[model samples]
Target: MQIVNENNLGEFLERKALKCKEAIKQNASLLNRFLNLCLVFDECKDDLDNAHILECSSFKELFLKKAKEEDGYFKITQDIKALDFMQLNFLVNQCANFLKSQGLKANDKVASFLQNSLEFVILYFACFKSGIIFVPVNACYKEDELAYIYEKTKFNYIVAEDELLAYVKCDVLKLAKSSFLKSILKHKKDFIMPKINPLDLAMILFTSGTTAKPKGCKITHYNLLFAGYFTLHQIGLRQNEVFLSSMPNWHIDLQATALMPSLRANACFVLLKRFSARRFWQQIVFYEANISEVVPKMIELIKLQNKFAREKKHKLRFLLYFLNMSNEKYLEFKKRFKVDLFTSYGLSESIVGCIGDNYYEKMSYPAIGKVFFAYEVIVANIKENKLIPLKANELGTICIKGRLGYELFAGYYEDELNTKNSFIDGYFISNDIGYFDENALFYFFSRNKDLIKINGENISSLEIENLLSSHKKINNASVICISDALACDKIIAFLELKEYPYKEEVNILQKNKELKQIEKELITLNLRLAKFKQVSEFIFLNHLPRNYLGKVRKNVLGEIYGRN
Candidate 1:
């Protein structure tokens, strides 16, 4: 006689579905059609045990339940091996016990410093079970970058591969043995779950550090789940579908786009070690994948390869892109591959900043779709204590508010000063500048700060300048973003020589040697930087443009020498 379940899960689902419906009211008919289709299948209770179903509170809960129900459920495919849910759960249990034995309690920081593999996935869920904060450090990070993160968090444990052990200066428990899986299986699978809450810190995602040092954005379990469910509703992803994911694990979209949505929809996620133009379509066809996450640069690279035949042979419904693309390229891709393109905008703080294509209504090529459900977005002037609303098509700082407790990020991890500075009138201030059209579709213009986005990676101009300025021969240096066709921007460095008109210039061969030495020093400095953060080109200048206050005029440098 009860329409809803006793645990209020049914009620929660209904409320969330209603919110989704209201958010996409423009496509109400489409929602109704999808709902009707969902009713055609059994309600997933036919074979699952009652005990397994009772513990389904979060994604981790649901994953554990599914593992128990169908021990052979093919959940993940990496390389050529398909791992069942039970096998993956066993790994998670072992990791949880390992962390527990190390005396790591709830909210203890555990740094994940490895590649994208089954082990990385295990560490991810292990943190969820043990109530440890998961800090994602990209595997390719150099020693200096890794040292900074270690100094800030002082993590209690680190899970890394043996090859990357040199970067760890902290005296934490380093599990770098290649035979870890064999050792973990010896541990008992029965481990106690920690007491966790929706508000507990789930992750500490460091931003690109456009200003100075990077600030870690604190995210909660509820925030991740909310973004996952919202993505599921917006994309209309069907159950038992395959999702092809090649994005870096450190990126927020990797979770928001592939992991969480696939778990919520009960789908299989195909994880690639890295993006490869040659193997992309082959893997898609092999897995029969229905969705893929990509960037504009990848698309351009695919087209350059001229793999036209393979592009249309697979069953991809759409591709998810983050940055903007020209209308010509968007339509050309649709015509060639017979798949829709969904472009979006989001920062490390909020995974789902703006909704991509919903497939209900037609959207402009580059317009990022409407604001997500349960979140209010506005284009307004960010004053000291208030937000002044702007008219349609008027450029202003993008702001968002709603359900900050459960739907938004918590705050910066340890920096109280930055955490306090990022908010105004209880709204999260997105430093990116943009405006909304009359049709309510938002378009991105540029970052208000001098942050450079290159090939889906955020690079700080100041970070580059600081590195280049360390050279003894370089008196000063400036870094700026220049338009690039492949990635969004190419980093260019302009350096001023400490001593000009050298006597070596009188001798041609000696001058050439001096230039080569300078180039070698710059390249050596680049070895310390991440691949995406490396300077694309360097230009030597006698003097750098500066103002009366001795501030380097970066904009002037961009105009004078940024024409690439």
Candidate 2:
């Protein structure tokens, strides 16, 4: 798989649209017009600065133009018209006014516990439009987890669904909790809007707790807008482009890829309640969505769909995947879907979409693409407390800096110590290790903490897990290093099988044999690993515990594997 260059990208987009039986000739014309307008806007920012033009209105006009020209195109699931964007802005103003009338002051943290709905968008924008800081809690979090975040963030007000209100237990907190129910009853009429600046905190997204407790990353309006604008440019998304979002909006992946990017481009966004493999293709066909952001797991699930099996093809033009798809699978997906595939690497702390690679690039180098606009990448050695720029193809820890780097979250909410520790001097240390190849493509190896040091040799748990995952019989796998009395920490592979024949018969011995077979597979995998990094033990589990983001909970696995 070669890195897709600009020429390759053009060809790929053309081929994708052709497969959909839609002529790109018309789309290209519309795209040119939209792109030209964007260029004009970019060149003449002074005139637009005071226009007060609603973002949604711009999106609707473009959407209608495309639909009208394309014959009632299937482009969006949301009923987004020019009026909707204006109405949304108006609603946000109203909501902000309502909050202020309730006596909430500027810089007040307004927590929202809701799914990806119109209301979520309203509340988010309302917070930003006003001076309030929005704290979006993951709806999938358990009551206890939510409570931890609430306490950590110390939000003064919370807009929550009626169902989620039950999870609020006042007895657990040392400080008194302000009830939204009581607030509405007490002062319903006093709410007004608060003035805000671009620097004002817009959101606080918690990192998925895969290795440790989740930490909140506080992002500002400037950070989001800057990142959003650059991302839209990088992806070449134009007004009238129908963007489909399937991932949970709370995650930074969705925020950077879909929500913010769409708004920045004034593009139509189709938000789904949840990802459904069955309805994925149907929705694409129905909406005529031109672009979508997907995770690797979702792609695998979609490949399993019966509709996909029978239909033989799809109309998708472009797919931006967050996870690293293997070169083999990447090529196969391109051939099968007839769409351009783009992969990128990013984290919540960065606030910006760091690096990305589109599928049309002929160079199949494993790098996560080049540094985003105004961002610079550096490979450094942490131990010496020194900066070491590795030559192309030399593996090292990756660090980022520059103007775009400043757009990274201000800090963790209420945890100044952790925030201070996250950065080294000026450059923010991402804690992930990777290296750029000769083509300047970045390849992520594993998190700094995820590396297991056995007898001074560092081992990547992710690398081992990736290998085991390639096996057809293994449904999921997690690799962890556990301490041994004599040998120090030794690698242990935990596996979940796709099929266990003995489960029906309720035969423990047969199940053990199946587990042993998996262990044998791990033994073979051990040969490729360093001597000290080889798996010394194997554990067969019905399932591996995962966080809300579906990443394997390595901390929990450490405890389980250690206990056994």
Candidate 3:
């Protein structure tokens, strides 16, 4: 059976959700998870004819529709090659078969710690063909980040680039980039492809939370479709339009908005290995891309490179820019590059491009625009057990109303308490402060208030502090982000020493040597951190400044770093 009986799929997902919750509490492994591959729960076959899942297109259905198309393909600029629709679908199925060969079962999890390479994309889609859940671990995550995600996910298999194999601590089945790439191309094996339900979990994307632990957002197949369709309609994409982006494929912008939208609209996509200031315009020119994704930081970097003239003849229709930029720079960048910026706002927990600007009209630089269709956005607050909707020009919390697993994310993976707490009065409280003008145009005030966005990726200060505090020689650590002219934010770590507290001691020379050693070890740790998360500098502090409420004054830390 290529498809699970939709009637039974819902019950199965419900059971799975409960199972996940129990597993989360018990910290247990999935026992006897390798269900004999062909068991299709035939008891519910009678109820399959009128199931709603059949009405919607899963990734499998999407692939089948485009498999026969001869004109559409994804151009991987890094490899200098393109995979036509037929070959893309064929390879994806083959990857699925390869997973089956390793005893992976439906609902089993595989952690993909990879960059924006072809294998990453193929393995992701293959999970849909088979019924495994895709857990995308940040490719740049260090041993600490990797271990945390590994523990949370309880992955049955892991796929990483050959260079990153040392970071995989588990003995679970490992697939090195070179071996997997060669193996998938060899033969098409005969295997029964499980039919997928639209509501089934497709991916678990872990976004940093205010706490030390990251929150894994559960993305369903239907949510992926909805996000893509919404963004495609929002931007008014046309068939065969070439979309391009260099953001990590693990990010929502690249996957939901750029890639999925292209597939939904029957458009082509261009994948770059990473963003480059020097080659930014050249890739667009070379690829003949009609649309590209960028953040304000990237725009700033590209501007500083001043290589605009080299690829001035690029055919990019517009740049889908995110976050706010200084109006002076925003206007100057547009006038200088002669390209329109498509500004939009979204979160990992929300739909991609959930709120955005309509480029068709006169543009507003800071206003992120209104909510897209099939979802509702309201700015309000729950005061004294009552819902109070804010009027125009009134600042309040921005909330989104959408059906779970469709318009919004399913919930935080295996975190039912947070998932339950996140929703209030039928709306997902975004915890973002914003206001709408009389024109119903929404402006972003702040989202992820305690989080920092460096190079379009969100990094939680608490996560950094939690990791740094674990160092044996360090008594405590405080992290702060400072503004930069080129990079969006620069992180500075203020550490409290366990031994070297004062400089006037007689053993100062020995302490200085120990300090140098500690700094060297930290440099190694910083190297493992995603480049953006690496601290620009480290400052020794006896104690972090705290208010009477006992909260670390990060602002004070930033000030101290600047003063030093």
TM-score of each: 0.81, 0.64, 0.81
Q: Is candidate 1 or candidate 2 better by lDDT?
A: 1
Writing each residue's lDDT as its tens digit, candidate 1 over 1-564 gives 111121212122334334444544655343232321110111122233223223432222333324222221223111222343444555567777877877888889999887766667767877877788899887878888888888888888888878888888778887884755655665766566656767678788877755656678787777677766777777777776777788888888887777777756756676766776655665566556788877888877766555634456778877777877788887776776677777677777766645456746564558887876777788899766789988889999888775543666787778888877778887778888889999888888878546877767777778888888899998877888776665446778878778865341211123367867897889899889877788887777767777699887777777767343
Q: What ranges in model 3 sit over 4 Å off?
A: 1-78, 189-192, 306-310, 382-387, 472-475, 496-528
Number of the candidate with higher TM-score, 2 or 3: 3
Q: RMSD (Cα, Å) of candidate 2? A: 15.0
Error of 3 at 199 (Å): 0.8
lDDT of 3 at 260: 71
Against the true structure, candidate 1 reaches a TM-score of 0.81
Each model's backbone clash number: 0, 24, 2
* lDDT computed for candidate 2: 0.59
Model 3 Cα shift for residue 431 (angstroms): 2.7
Q: Whose TM-score is greatest here?
A: 1
Per-residue error at 196 for model 1, in Å? Answer: 0.9
Model 3's C-alpha root-mean-square deviation from the true structure amounts to 13.0
